[model samples]
Target: MKRALLATTLCALPMAAAAEGELNLYVWSDSIDPALIAKFEAEAGVKVNVDGYNSNEDLLTKLQAGASGYDIVTPSQHFLKIMADQGLLEDIDAHALAAFQQVDPKWRGQWWDEANDYSIPLAYGTAGFTVNRNHYKGPVDSWKVLFEPEADLQGKIAMLSYPDEIIGAAQLYLGVPFCSEDPAEMKRVYDLLAAQKPFVAAYTSDNIENRIAGGEVAAHFWWDGNSMKIRFNDNAPIEYAMPKEGLVGWLDSMVVPKGAPNVENAKKFIDFMSRIENATAQYNFYGHSAPVAIDTATAKYTAENAPELFPTVKVEFSRSCSPAAQDLVTKVWTQLLQ
Candidate 1:
C-alpha cells in the first residue's frame, strides 16, 4: 500500500489546485523574515504556518518518525540527497516553475539532486569561525586557534554541537578527507575534538549569534551568514574567517515532502522565493546569499562591504559519510558532551 501510494503521487501531474490555502513551512529558526511571510500571505491569500528546527538531523528525525502536515521543508544539500534516496520528497517539475530560471545554473543540476528533480536551491554559504575582535587581537585565519587553542584562546571558545560539522572541521584541520572511512583517520578527529573539549566554553547550535554578541565567548565555530547577520544587525564586534584549512560549503534548498497537503502552494512559495527581489530581501534579512544572482547594485554593495560572505579559499561541500563512520563520530560526540 505504501509503495502504491508513493507511485501514484509521483505519477500525478504537477497541479496548482490548492493555490490559496495554507503552506506549512518547516525551516531553520529565524530563516524567513516574518514581514516576508506577511507579504506572501497578503498577496497570495494563503496563510503560511511556520515551524522551526535547528539542525538538518532534527528535521530528518521528525519526518522519519512519521510527523506530517509540513508542506515544505528546508534541508541542507547533504541531507537532501539522503531524503531523496529514501523517497521522502516529492519530485519538483522544473517546467512548472517559471522562476526556476532565475536560479544560477551552477546551483542547478547539483550532485545532490541531479536534473533538479527534488530540491530548489534556497541559500548558500560557508561554515567557519568568528572572533570577537574586541577580545581577541591575534589573527583569526586558521582552525588551530579554535582546535589547538593558544593561551589566550583556551577556555574562551565555542564549538558547533553537530557531529558532522565539528568532526568535519577537525578532519580538515588534520588534512583528512571530510567523509573519510578510515578508522584511524576518524579516531584522530575524535581525539582532536576530545582534547579541545576542555578548552571549549560551550557546545551549542542555538542563539549562537546572540551569545557571541553578548560576549559569552571570544570565538565560535559558526556559519559565515550568521556571523555577518550578527555583525550587521547587532553591531557585534565580531569578524568571520575561512580557516586556512579549507572551509566547508553548504547549500540549503527547499523541498516538498511526500504527502504534502499543500503541494501547489509549496511550489508557488518556492517560485516566489526564486525571484530576484524576493531573493535579495531574504539575503539582506538573513545574511546568506541566495543561489540566484541579484541586481548589479546589490551585488556590488555586497562585494565592497561584505566580502567575507563570499569565500575565496578552497571549499569542501559536506557529504554523507558511511554509517559506520557516522556512528563513530556520534559516539565521540556523545563522549565529548559528557
Candidate 2:
C-alpha cells in the first residue's frame, strides 16, 4: 500500500508541473521580448514555454501535422483563416474573452474571417522599401523602384522571396486586385514578379535591416515592423514608406490551437495581451505596429508619431487566394528563386 501511494505521487508530479504553470507558445523568433513572457507569467501564474518559427508555412505544417503542444500561436490573418477552416483552431468564445471587445470595430469583421470568430488581431503593418535619404535622390513613394529598377538601383535592390508580398506588389503596381483567388490574375502577378526577379539583388526574407543599415543595398522591400526595428536599433537616416501605388500589407493574430492544453489560461493570456498598454509596449519594443482600437493611447501614438503606418486592405479587396492560387504562386516563386 505504501509503495502504491509513492507511485501515485510520482505519477502526479508531472501533471502538477504541467498544471501549476506552463503555456507552450509558438511564434516568430526574436519577435517578442523575454520580459513580455516574464510579465505574463508573473501576472497570470503560468510559465510560458515559447518556440519560434521563421515562416507561416512552417507553423501551418506543424499544426496540420497534428503537433498538439501549443496553447497559443501567432500567424498572419490569412494563415489564421486556413487553420480555422482546417479545424486546427478553437472557435474563440467572445464571452470568455472580455478584452476582445477592445479590438477595433474595423478589424473585427474583416472579410478574411468575418465576425472576429477565429482569432484576434495582434499587429498590423505593410511591406515597402526604406529609402536612404542620403543616397536616394529620386522620388521614393512607389513600388516602381524595385519593379522598374533605375540605372543606379540595378542589381543593388532587394525584393521579398514570398509569393504573396512580391506578387501582390506587382498587382498593386498594375492597379489590379491583390490576394486574388482568380488563378489567371494570380498567374499574371506571378509572371510580373518573376520578370522582376532577374534584377533583384537576392530573394530575401531576412537581413533587410542589415542591408539597409550597412548600405550594402540601397533599398529593399521589407515589413514596416522590421524597418522600424532597424530605425530603432541603429537610429539610421533611413525611412519606411508605403509604395506610391500603395503597399502590400499583413495583419497577424493570436489564436488558440485546436488541441491547446490550457485554453482558459490562453483566453486570459489573450485578454492580458489585448490591452492597449501591453500592445503599445510590444509595438515600441519590437518596432512592429501594434493592433490598436480607436481612441486608445497607442492609436494616438501611431497617429501623432508614425502616421504612415496604415491598415492592410488586400485581405478585404481580395479573397486571400484559393489553394490552387497559392500552389501556383509557390511554384512560380520557386522557379524565380532558382
Per-residue alpha-carbon lDDT of candidate 1 for residues 1-338, written as tens digits (9 for 90 to 100): 23332432332223225335778888887788666776676668776777778899999998887757899899999899999888899897753576678888888788898877778888888888899988888887788888999988888898877886778788889998877778788778878988888899988887787777787889989898888876776688999876889788899999999889989888888888878887777877777877876765564237557766878778789997668777877877887777
- Candidate 2, overall lDDT? 0.70
Candidate 2 ranges beyond 4 A from true positions: 1-19, 179-187, 293-301, 310-319
Per-residue CA lDDT of candidate 2, range 1-338, in tens?
Answer: 23333443454454455445667778777666566666776676676676777677789999998956898899887788788878899887643476677777767777667767767777777766776656566777677777887877777777765666667677788766755567677667667776676677787777667787777777777776676655655677677765557776678888989978888888887887777677766766666666654335543335445544653333222235676666766776776767
* Residue 11 displacement in candidate 2 (angstroms): 26
Error of 2 at 203 (Å): 1.0
lDDT of 1: 0.80
Give TM per candidate.
Answer: 0.91, 0.85
| C-alpha lDDT of residue 232 in model 1 | 70
Q: In model 1, which range of ten residues has the least summed lDDT? A: 7-16
